[model samples]
Target chain A: MIRHVILRVMAKMLIPLILLFALYVQFHGDYGPGGGFQAGVIFGAGIILFALIFGLEPAKAAFPPRVLEVLVAVGLMIYGGTGIAAIVKGGNFLGYGALSHDPVHGQHLGILLVELGVGITVASVMSTIFFHFGGRGRKDV
Target chain B: MIDLIHIFLFTFLAIIAIVVIRMRDLFAAVMLMGIFSLLSASLFTVMDAVDVAFTEASVGAGISTILMLATLSLTTSKESTLYQRPRPLALVVVVLTGAALVYATFDMPRYGDAAAPINHHVADYYIARTMDDTGVPNMVTAILASYRGYDTFGETTVIFTACVGVMLLLGGARTFYRWRRREDAGDPEPRP
Candidate 1:
């Protein structure tokens, strides 16, 4: 019980900090050594920690499996949609310069959209994996 | 001074790898593998490949270890000694491969030569045009998300596929929920 309480408190404190760092990494990718992939993993780690401390049931209650499943598909769709949009704009798939009238702005928008997609998919998939493994029942103590 | 530290790290990494391979306990081996990955990430940082280092530290050291532990929980942790005898044919093939690799390295450019073909041609373009192209200060990010975006997309798809496969094989969230519901229904009296 004591261990559970401590874990809960620690999860509450650490998860927020991790999430904040993930956001920092996501937005600051243009200036630093981080981007969508790293940020996504970090964010996912936060959720995984919460799931670990709290029971998988509670974690599932917090973020339902159905929601995560949708998020995963939606993320891919967002990424693919952006690429398709570029193609529709008369450029190669994911050719962001054609996204807008101003090529630089188009590039920025493209990166942001794609990064968001990557972050969402990675975070959802990772958390889902954690739930699967940690929630598994063990016959042996 | 940094170069000395790097050499030390490399030597330490080799020692750790040998230990991990020789270790009889699977759990200990998995933990050692995590440490090995972390050391490798640090080595990548020392080599100035911070992006690769970050990926290594997160995915390699974190998720991979968790996956290995989960697998261990589901299976026997015993190390099978069935194939303990070293095969002469395998040894000969390994030695030949090593010799070929070493010979190929001699023909390649020395460690950090700026005039090397890698630095002069494709790499130079990314380093120079990254800022202009993607408006990102991190050239690696620009390269990964833009110039080599196809590869990144493919990798992401691979990760997604693997996760889907694992979920399908291991009984996903739906099964877990059903199990919980059955447990709840079995209990007639709700106890706080």
Candidate 2:
């Protein structure tokens, strides 16, 4: 692998911008053309870029596999927990009407929370998969 | 016009697909697949599905390409020279499937026909009441996260399952457990 200083400097500059764009996509899905999936993938791509420019060990230090596994599970919980909340509130499974007093507010809150869950899971999983596949057969690993 | 753009995209897509098939080099095929994804993403955007387009472009052009490259690094960069003839049965099967798919397209509703079955279904209700029901301007988000929350949940589960499966197949589970055991013994952790 060619370790070019110019590539290193450019990656350092671009990483933060990429992550910020991902956040925008995450929260802006409600009013525009983005959502958890796109945001998550973008964020994962950013981290992957960081790993590519730097190395696998540094990337793992930044985001550990253990933490990623937990995050993957947590995202699913956030999604499932929302449905359970609705059921507890005397609504049907996955129904958001009972989430708040106003149906609209309930829907908004539910969507936001669920989308967040999806974003976290997707981002973590993609990164984790990268770690696994890339780390394989490496002398460092 | 949108129709013209769609025609251009599909034409490009067909050419890319043919090139990808003809190319024996795995690396070139992968690159062509990315181009194929880009064209399809453009078509999706033209059809007003910006969300899908964004996803297809990002995943197809970015992470997947990198991962495949990483795989090529681990394996041989060049495809092996196998001078095997094409199977007659496989070609016939592919041709029959293509014909069937083309025939099936005739039954599909025309692009964005308001009178289409899908447009007449729950889509109308969602569009009519999205603001009142969800207060979200993005109907796709409102529907995917709230109205069709169950389906999204299922999709999330599928992703989770796939992740877990990969972890198992890639020995992530073994290493993680071993690392934990080592940590219990107060041993220093080495870089993975």
Candidate 3:
């Protein structure tokens, strides 16, 4: 640890805000300039900042590698599953029209879910890459 | 005013690119690359491509900079000056490519030309129907997530594939650390 009190205090204050902003970007994509890809990177960046300030072990403790690896696959599954779901409902692949009673609402729901899936996968993969990269050459694994 | 901003940003971009190319310190080059990305992101914002700007800022300036710094720490911060010989062939190739690109730009439609061929194609339809079809206010999102859902899915899959590839190569972090430790301990024939 750097023993820099100001750095610690600022990081503590900023991490939550970064994460909240990422979620805002994620769900607010329909109304704004952000979406799943941007949100995921922002979210991963928040975690990376945490790791940078607090050290890798503590950050890994907060977000285990096992959980991150699982989330990576789960996000892709959610995306693919959404398409399969449309097929099951007798619509074309990734056709949001049949996901609900109202076609417009179905589209809305499908977009939201799909964006969520993208966000989750991107976030986890980014964090995983950072973890593995940062872990190299350290005596403690 | 926007044109002035564009010129100013481009000037800075050119300066940074030259400086990055000439810089011998890898750390400084990485920082300059981040600045370059930030400038391009601003340019994208100026052009009303907010989504692209957001992505460029995050992925280009943010994540990639950090990764480069991390890699620098793991390796050397000073770029090796062994390849200092100037190659005339390389210069000729680069100049030819640059000239060709500049020449091709002459045929491009003026910036923000509403009647351009590209705007007349599917863009007009998407712009008109996005709200009705997807009920999303952001046309970019509507097109990405609904109108061109297959493309977005492919992009997501690409990201997933990149992650899987990285994980496969670097997943064995413990093994890597162990190998490093053996090398540090002066083992001539360390186990693979």
Candidate 4:
């Protein structure tokens, strides 16, 4: 269908830009109008676009349910693990100052890890929501 | 000059909201809602809340619209002509609340006043301490990810729970096939 082809082309062009923007938002949070949460949503939007264009079945094929489920769990674990790491280092949970030899470096590392977790969980959950809604058999386009 | 642009944007946003609410076709209403969200995001940007604007633009205008459209595809496009009786008491109450809010705004600080109580109090501390403590220049990010980390965790959990509920309630392909097979067998029970 023309819609499919147009969507595919748009996905090819726009997704990369979105991903790059996510990185820009993630790394440049300290200076600009974006951060972990914004970056995560933008990244999720890119994946959602791909899913929308390719159909839910193909999207599922590309990102298996088990893979998405695991990523969701892993993201949570990573976020929690960072907090636990801080606690183990004689600080309270999510105490980034206790993360490494240098307090500032530790903060950077902690933020990065937590942001990665946020991005993963957000992207997975968004795609999962789309898949769930779009995968209904009797639904007409 | 900027004030004039802001006023124009505000007018545009108001029109979009009116159209969204007034539209009879559900699909058109939903699409108009997307426009409404985008206009809201623009309004946020003009209000100097860039981060909130970005989230609103992406989530409200983009993802939420797509989700609504998908759901719409599964349902009837035509609306029933049933009419509901208007509640004059409720209407009066809503109007009174709106008037009160508009009146209260007259006593508030002008837009972006650095000497405002909001800027001088808690916001000042967060803005000052955020850079030294979190090493991030963006105070919002520091506040969200570090100071308010628990709230973010709670939000993530909420998303996960919603996804789980969606999966459970919306039966998968196998269940759909089973239901279809039963329908083919001429059972009196209606199919989901």
Candidate with top DockQ is 3
> After superposing the true interface residues, what Cα RMSD does each candidate give?
1.4, 0.8, 0.7, 1.5
lDDT of 1 by residue, B1-192 (tens): 998989989998999999988888999999999999999999999888898899899888987787788778878677877776778999999999999999999999987888888888798778777778878777777777778777878777876886788688665555655667767889544422
lDDT of 4 by residue, A1-141 (tens): 237676678788998899899888877776787776677778777777767776666767777876886776677777788889999998889887899888877877787787777767776777777777777754432
RMSD of 2: 3.6
lDDT score, residue B25, model 4?
A: 89
lDDT of 4 by residue, B28-101 (tens): 88888888899889889888899899889988998899999988898866666778899999999999999999
Off by over 4 Å in 1: A1-9, A138-141, B172-192
Which candidate achieves the best TM-score against the true structure?
3
As a whole number from 0 to 100, the lDDT of residue B69 in candidate 1 is 83
Supply the global lDDT for candidate 4. Answer: 0.78
| Evaluation by lDDT, superior candidate among 1 and 4 | 1
- Model 4 spans > 4 angstroms off: A1-5, A139-141, B171-192
Residues A1-141 of candidate 2: C-alpha lDDT, one tens digit per residue: 329999999999999999999999999999999999899999999989988999888998998888998999999999999889988988888788888888778878889889999999999989999998998876567
Clashing pairs in 4: none
Which should have the higher DockQ, number 2 or number 4? 2
Q: List residue ranges in candidate 3 displaced over 4 A.
A: B173-192
Per-prediction TM-score, please? 0.87, 0.90, 0.93, 0.87
- lDDT, each prediction: 0.81, 0.89, 0.92, 0.78
Highest-scoring model, lDDT: 3
DockQ of each: 0.57, 0.84, 0.84, 0.60
Clashes of 3: 0
Q: Model 3: per-residue lDDT, tens digit, A68-135? A: 99999898888888999999998999998999999999999999989999999999999999998898
- Could you give the DockQ of candidate 4? 0.60
Sort by DockQ, top down from the best:
3, 2, 4, 1
